[model samples]
Target: MVLKNILHHRFFENFLKYRYLLTELVKRDIKVRYRRSVLGIFWSFLEPLLFMIVLTIIFSTLFSRSIENYPVFLLSGRLVFMYFSQSTNGAMRSIKMNSPILKKLYVPKYIYTIALTLSALVTFLLSLIVLVMVMLATGAPFTPYIALFIVPTVLLTVFNIGVGLILATINVFFRDMEHLYGVFLTLLMYSSAIFFPPDVIPVDFQWILTWNPVYAMISLTRDLFLYGQMFDTFTLIFATISAIASLVIGLVLFYKYQDKFILHV
Candidate 1:
């Protein structure tokens, strides 16, 4: 009975009640993102494709000997990092961005962060079409392992939501967080080995790649999609732990401080 009551608690009730609003918020975010753009949603398809082309052109001579089908390798890692970067950034700004509606309404504050992340997820999924096209064009073989790509994708999304919640909570208090996080993301992108291979890192620094959840996810996807193999046990275990820990920490902080958000925002 206690579990049942908890399951249907008013918190969950509010989510169900406001579910429609969440859907509208996600739609609005996507529409507003491309509002004045020429190609609008198609940019989702083109942006990653263009980025992959440029990176392949620039780095092909340097790393092509080490990485086979370099375009696929680069695109797989780039897409995962791009989603993490975009989703987390959007979620960080979500609370402040929707302050006007928040002040006048009683909707759950976390909804804004979730809507932003989901919108980014929608964009990321669309970009995968470009990944598929590149894979076929480059003659990267499709294997049954490709289906396992969903495992890392789901874990990465959970990790993003967790990190997004924490960032949103902090950003509410510190306006400078926006700029600071941009710098951190730049560092993170470099550390993720998106454009380079793990072997490029010195032997002493290999643990940086091993412990980095973002890189773990990227490497996992690359294993499935590019290399046609299952991800190693350590990467899977570490990524799972990282994702769950982030979510737990993010939830604890966000809920503990959420009531104070209106004062700061």
Candidate 2:
């Protein structure tokens, strides 16, 4: 019955309109990120740059024998990991952050989720440019196969959207989700092989990393950058299912908790 209303609702019918609003919200988020800073958009350049420099120094000096070209290696994994993290982390607090809009507008509310995702996507593009520049300067292999990365890139977007949707809905009731997310995401970064090669992780625990969807997502990006071939098709398919499931759950939970947000927040 609830599904019937969702199907029949005018907002559902006019999804393109909602999607356009999401674009505007994304734009607002991008501008607000740099509002008063003297450096403005340049600040976005600092984070990934510093991260690459710090890690490059640490890995090159400490683990020189184990990993080669750690700068390029980590950059490949970190960029993809950063996108997934940014999308989910931004989305978790999206509902609360947009309180003014929620209070004033009787909009379908899912618009906020879409908006936050779009905002993260803006940064994702900006960061990718810097990543490409570093790759070319460092003499990382350039290949025609890099173009094929669009498939998994799109897949990652859907996967994150599903997970982000679910988390944002729950956050309305349990504000602690936001605080706890940092810890979860930190551990997630390690598990995704952003810092070290998967080989270094213990053999017994290797499946934990190999089976993880985040790991596969990172692997896809690495293949696009390092090798000129598609990778791990079975894992990719499984991850796609996981992503779709996440979205369905997130949407359902959001709709279920829609009434409680006004009371709780």
Candidate 3:
């Protein structure tokens, strides 16, 4: 009874009322992203492939022995990290970038950030085609476990939305957050073990990767896609908890500060 009531709540009703608007916003974001570019959407397929090729060329010899099918390993991790970086960055800037619309009309503010993340997700899904091509070219095994890749993808999306909300709210108040987040992302990319093998790090530092939610998602992808096995129990649990916590905190903060957004923007 309680669950049914919650499902029919006014908030959900409002969301449904604005569903069309959300769809349009997502389409606009994707279109804007590829506007004036020659290759356009194909870049989604090519960008990650090019990145994988360059990174593999440079690091293949270094970790080739330690990591089997180094290209597949590299590409899998890279895709996850790329999605995370792009989605969060887009979400962070969604508010200010659309300030004109926000000021002119009354719409759900969260819709802007959600639209950015969803647009990024669309590109990320399309990029997975490149990952498939690389896997086939490299002769990486295709296993049933690959179907479970959705688990981490969904979790990561939730986590992105949560973080996006927090960043969008803060970004409205502090324009400097955009610059600071760029530096933070650089540090995060290094710490994520994207280009390097985590095993190379000392045992003492293993905790760093273990505790990182983004690394957890990346490692989960590698496990399913490259290793042909189930993800670690701890990783799944940690990722779920981290994602939920982020969303809860983000909602709390976003709603609390959302009214003030009009003042700043």
Candidate 4:
């Protein structure tokens, strides 16, 4: 009953009461991200476009014939992965970075992490336009299945928020976590099958991809956009469960540790 009440208070009541603060924080983060940059918001559209172009050139030369519609395949996965990477990295520093404001105010601590995640989500949605254009330009077939992209997208968002919360909480205690996570994200990016197809991976070692949540999301995105095929039911179920579990764990950790964050920060 204690745990249930805590969950309701932190996850439901606080969120509803502070919804405006969350929105303002999210807006502040978005503005801070593009502040003083001449390109400003256009960078959101450009980053993914440029990344797709560069990777398409490099990977296509190597695997072009092997992978049909390589641009669509790459962009679909890359865009989502970029959002996850950026959101988590930003959230990891959200608490420490905002320590001044946190020190002065009584705001709920999770606001910083959630705001950072939403800011990244906004950028991810903007870049998705480029992904759709790449699909159309590459002549990838789109079906009504495309409408269901929301399923994986929602799952991925929840996963990112959970991961962000945990990272934010940890980084408050461990200053070195930021540098360590940067290296980890680089390794995760390559291992996620963003630049390569899973078939090329050894059958014996395929479970690595099979168990990876990020890869599951990428595969689902590819199926929805490029292949116009139904997503694997098992993968979908596993990803949803994994996302929910992460969110619950993250919330508990953050709730437990939030009071101590100011001292560490």
For each candidate, give its TM-score against the true structure.
Answer: 0.97, 0.90, 0.98, 0.95
lDDT of 3 by residue, 1-265 (tens): 9999989986588789999998999999899889979999998998889998998999999998889988888888888998999999999999999998889899889988889999889988998889899999999899999999899989999999999999999999999999999999999999899989998879988998999999999999999988999989999999999999988888789989988888898
Better of 1 and 4 by lDDT: 1
TM-score ranking from best candidate downward:
3, 1, 4, 2
lDDT of 2 by residue, 77-177 (tens): 88778888888888888888888768877777777876777677777778777778778877887788788777777878888887888888888889999
Instruction: Indicate whether candidate 2 or candidate 4 has the larger lDDT.
Output: 4
On residues 94-126, what C-alpha lDDT tens digit does candidate 4 reach at each position? 999999999999988888899999889899888
What lDDT does the true structure give each of the candidates?
Answer: 0.91, 0.80, 0.91, 0.89
Q: After superposition, how far is residue 3 of candidate 4 from its true place, in Å?
A: 13
lDDT of 2 at 19: 72
Highest TM-score model number: 3
Error of 2 at 27 (Å): 0.6
lDDT against true structure, model 1: 0.91
lDDT of 1 by residue, 62-158 (tens): 9988999899999999999999999999999999988887788888888899888888888988988899999999999999999887798889989
lDDT of 1 at 239: 96
Q: What is the lDDT of residue 75 in candidate 4?
A: 90
